[model samples]
Target: MFEIGDKIVYPMHGAGTIKAIEEKELAGQTQEYYVINMKIGDMQVMIPASKIVSSCIRPITDIRALKQLIHNFHHGESDEVLPWKQRYKVNSEKIKTGEIQDCAEVVRDLLRMNKEKTLNSSEKKMLDHAYKFLNSELESIKGITDNQIKSFS
Candidate 1:
């Protein structure tokens, strides 16, 4: 039941604002869809209204929660004990969860690993995407600044 103008994050897709909701006919049926204006690529995604719940599209986290996330990030330990293949598998699953905390953990662990040793192409690309995805959602939060977002690393 998100309304137009609501800010939401779609798993793996980053954050966006709900631009419109429209109904269109196809195959003699009219299905409603939410038109989202994505921040990262300046693109639009039309999600079926009925599928919103199952799609994992969710509202952006509040500023207080983001501050708490940053606090945990600073205090939490990186979990890169798993071998590269396993580590990649775990990180991929975390990104798929679409939870801000999980995404932040992936970014933190990957950034630390990248500093210690060059990550393989796969991990490198995942870091870039997850970083952007996390940042986009953070940016959607009101009264947040670029400096605060950079502290995640």
Candidate 2:
């Protein structure tokens, strides 16, 4: 279970530190929720404590894991032949998973595709969001820097 001061990643929204855990009443029911101070966007989110697992809220990946992810990103190949619509759908789902590796793949694949051909506006926006989400989490890692994050691209 997460507590105040624990750092976590909320899928699609980016990473944050748990600032508080409180019980609140809504719809005549009282439930515990985690108040996260998001690292990006300077925002806060109140996530239902019971839904933590289902929502894909997870701890920040360690530096070692992140290094491995970066290595995979550099070596992996994207499915460039997939139609844009199909590719969009797949990438969107990956971003929703809140997994660092999946998010990195979305950023890497979209970037590689953009280098070959221009991505339509929708894909361009997705790339921006994915890149920001991945970078925000990377920033939370102790020794990583924006330069290292950019090198993944």
Candidate 3:
């Protein structure tokens, strides 16, 4: 049960703040909904309160753990060399987890792959989306930025 102003990450959609909890009638049912204002896109999303658990919403990560993950990610390798199809599946799964650490790896791996060879259209789109998610989460974590961005550089 997140209160108003609680920061949360919606899988594949990045981090957002709970702006309001409103009740609306839909299909003759007055159910509570969470109104989330997304950080990066300046967008708002409304999710049903009852479905929050299955929706994979999670609280924003702590600065300390985020820093540790950034450090480890910077030193980690990204040369598994899987075929494109398999790689896409793996990355998709990570993004679906809504975990900042996993999102960081997807960003790092895709960036590495991009450097070695130009990514195909689909992978390019995926990288762009993944980067947005990664950056949005990074922005959500107060007083942290450059290290994570620097890792891909």
Candidate 4:
């Protein structure tokens, strides 16, 4: 269970702060929902505790875990080039699943490609989204600004 002011990762939505906990009557029963305010935008979402796991609401990764992710992002790369359509399809799936590790994989793959040449609009947007998601979590855990994190990268 998350309390107000706690940071959580909402699949596809990235990192959000728990703004409030509220109870509402629905279907003749009272249920509680966590009100999450997105860090990157003016969006607020309500998630029921009963469905938290399925919704992929989870605590941010700890420092060690985050370091592992960074290491993987830095080291994991494929020399074989894949067709753009296939790469887009696979990366889209990873982004949709809202798994942090999967997002890291997408960032790593795109960064590798970028080193070789420019990316298409869609690929650039995906890379930006992944960077936003990871950077938010990194900022929260490291007590630094996203810009600072970007500077080091």
Residues 69-90 of candidate 4: C-alpha lDDT, one tens digit per residue? 7667677665367788888888
lDDT of each: 0.91, 0.90, 0.86, 0.78
Most TM-score-accurate candidate: 1
lDDT of 1 by residue, 29-142 (tens): 999999999998899999999999999999999988977899877778999489999999999999998999999999989988888899999999999999999999988899
For model 3, give the 10-residue run with minimal summed lDDT. Answer: 144-153
Worst 10 residues of 1 by lDDT: 71-80
Ranking by lDDT: 1, 2, 3, 4
Residues 1-153, candidate 3: write the lDDT tens digits. 899998899998999999999999999999999999998689999999999999999998877786588775778887489999999999999989999888888888988788889999989998889888977877787767686555644
24 in model 2: Cα distance from truth in Å? 1.5
Candidate 1, pairs of clashing residues: none
Answer with 1 or 2, whichever has the higher lDDT: 1
lDDT of 2: 0.90
- TM-score of every model versus the real structure: 0.96, 0.93, 0.91, 0.84
lDDT score, residue 89, model 1? 91
Stronger candidate by TM-score (1 vs 4)? 1
Residue ranges of candidate 4 with Cα displaced over 4 Å: 26-29, 142-148
Give the range where candidate 4 is weakest over 10 consecutive residues by summed lDDT: 143-152
The Cα RMSD in angstroms, rounded to one decimal, for candidate 3 relative to the true structure is 1.7
- List of clashing residue pairs for candidate 2: none
